[model samples]
Target: MSPQTHINFTANPPKLHYKPHINLTTNPPQPLYKPTSTSVQTYINLTTNPPQCHYKPTSTSLQTHINFITNPHQPYYKPTSMSLQTNINLTTNPHQPYYKPTSTSPQTHINLTTNPSQPYYKPTSTSLQTHLNLTTNPH
Candidate 1:
């Protein structure tokens, strides 16, 4: 019982179960092996089905219209000359009408468009007393 154990019990070698070599040769750059749509047992072989990949988003370059004033989480401010100036002086007797000190100029003027309904008084040329008490009667 020993001629190398009868040639290792009559030698039998041939078993490679995994046949897949498709080359229907019309040679246009073929070596494709694809199994990854985040692969988890995806072998799809209904005659190698692979022809569907689509992406389309466009209504003037991918549908986008955002102007929260150039949105930096929306809240941008710097606009004050009495909120972009809209002069309103509906003059009658909004507390004594006017004082014209455009000459004999002695100014300490901070009448940022004065409002008690347009009462801008900036005259200090050594007390040149100009007084107008328009006695309120504009009904």
Candidate 2:
């Protein structure tokens, strides 16, 4: 007779037999405790604009502000509020011969200086004559 061997095996893994109990009655799991008051306050503040902190003005910032106020050609310089008086002078003083003429005179000046030999000579001459007449008789 031939010899025979026998072996035994379990159908499921050991972990499946030891599953933890879950309480379906309760809502989703949450932290055991609340966050601190300061953390909560910081979260609230983050939702809005934070307060500006006080600090000494640096020399660079002061210089920039000064330059912005002083230099008329600077991009950040606000000429509207500061130079309104100058603009008024230009507009008002067009009637005065001592103050040159209106803003349009600059175009005539450019035409005379840059286009003296170009086809614009005739139109520029007519414009210059009109400007002279207007200046001589400001009414």
Candidate 3:
């Protein structure tokens, strides 16, 4: 009779070589939630001077209100009762169509600086010159 070799069924599993070379001192801790600004905007129909609707953030004390002007000279703003302040100024020549806009309120300042995670009202212009000038020298 030939001798037969029997394999052991209870052999140990192969070991995984894991290296712990993580640099704990090099990387800074990341923020869980980054800070962002929030603002509200009201839309106005240019074709018609009637106010369409007022859109705003669901939260309070962090809202910004804007009036969409179809014609820079002939502005059409809707009255808001949300207790938000309006701090907008635009400057233009008596003859030229171009104008500049300046934010006069603290909330406006925050909106200009931070990227508000809310809807913001923007004005429509026939040309790029009007857009650029309005922001710089807004009356």
Candidate 4:
């Protein structure tokens, strides 16, 4: 094999990636297992509002307590009282999207993933050929 990406790409998806516009660097990382944000969101257009994947890592003073009530109907668990307390780490970094998303609207191109192993790819109005191509190379 040529060790080159053998796909003949036109001007749409751009030549440098399997996907598009993913800024690997200058992006902050998220915590390992942070709780999902409880913010209100609709099925907003990604061009306006990008999907939230990473959580704010600066959760220095979070003490969450969860209480579970005993249910007689469910046989899976029989607990009198169960409470969970979680103390997330104090290290914090502001949340970052998958890639540098368009602060401006009409995002003509978008990257579908941040998975490092996959060949970089993006969906663009210009590049219909490489739109949403998720491949698994089980090396």
Candidate 5:
């Protein structure tokens, strides 16, 4: 009897192609040690503890008021056109309804007269005084 012949067959393994997934809409992952921008830090700080940094301006600068007005996160009182006119009248005459007329009317009147050179070129006087008082006294 002839010895049986042995045969072995082998097939090549399948090849796999790998491709990384990318998200076009999202930004690339930030580096672990990357420095944050000042604006970003300010925004984070503002969001984290908003009440702590109320940012009440001590000066009567129009730019400051404008900043307060423009800041979307902060709570600001945007005076109406009529209210603005009332403010003008109060500053010019000091005897007008005084907007929020109260027992403190005389004090507001004095502040308006004293700081006639305030920015915005008109009477932001009542609002300014009220803002200052509210920030300083907070009661």
Candidate 6:
């Protein structure tokens, strides 16, 4: 065998399985890495488990609530007039029957309060929303 052949030499270097070091000591702010419950539930409803990272959304915040309101994915974003009527109209227009309810007698008030037709009514069972569209638009 020639002297060149006998010499131990490597033409290519070994590839490194490189990975970034994580500092578990100091808590890193993970915005996108760990999504908020509001985001997960509101959007597509992610079924996968969250990574072992810090994200305490258990406590509610005004900022978080605002985020939900502004989010484009939220169902209440569009139909601005409807949202304003249902949510904002109460404070502005106190004369609204559903909001103030001055017409209904004491005896009938309880029954009307429980009725699903009322804007603030909460059905005992899971019921489909009946907007009573025919009230305004008659076919």
lDDT of 4 by residue, 1-94 (tens): 1111112222322334322111111112222322221221111111212334452222111111221111121222211211111211122112
Q: Give one digit per residue, the lDDT tens place, for model 5 in 6-124.
A: 21212123113312111111012222222111110000000111222332222111110111121121122232211111111111112321122122221122112212243232224
Which scores greater on lDDT, model 3 or model 4?
Answer: 3
Error of 4 at 120 (Å): 53
lDDT of 3 by residue, 26-117 (tens): 01222231212122222111111122133111211222222222122222222222222232223344443332222222122211111234
Whole-model alpha-carbon lDDT for candidate 2: 0.18
Once model 2 is optimally superposed onto the true structure by TM-score, how far is the C-alpha of residue 36 displaced, in angstroms?
48
Who wins the lDDT comparison?
Answer: 3
Per-residue lDDT value at 73 in model 2: 19
Q: lDDT value for candidate 3? A: 0.22
Q: For residues 18-111, could you state the per-residue lDDT of candidate 1 as single tens digits?
A: 2211111111222331211111110111110122123111111111110111112112211122111111111124332432112211111121
Q: Rate residue 65 of model 4 by lDDT.
A: 21
TM-score of each: 0.11, 0.11, 0.15, 0.16, 0.12, 0.11
Q: Which of the two, 1 or 3, has more lDDT?
A: 3
RMSD of each: 43.2, 39.8, 29.2, 23.0, 32.0, 29.5
Reference-based TM-score, model 5: 0.12
TM-score of 1: 0.11
lDDT of 1: 0.18
How would you encode candidate 2's per-residue C-alpha lDDT over 5-71 as one tens digit per residue?
1112122222223211111110122223121111000000001011223311111100000011221
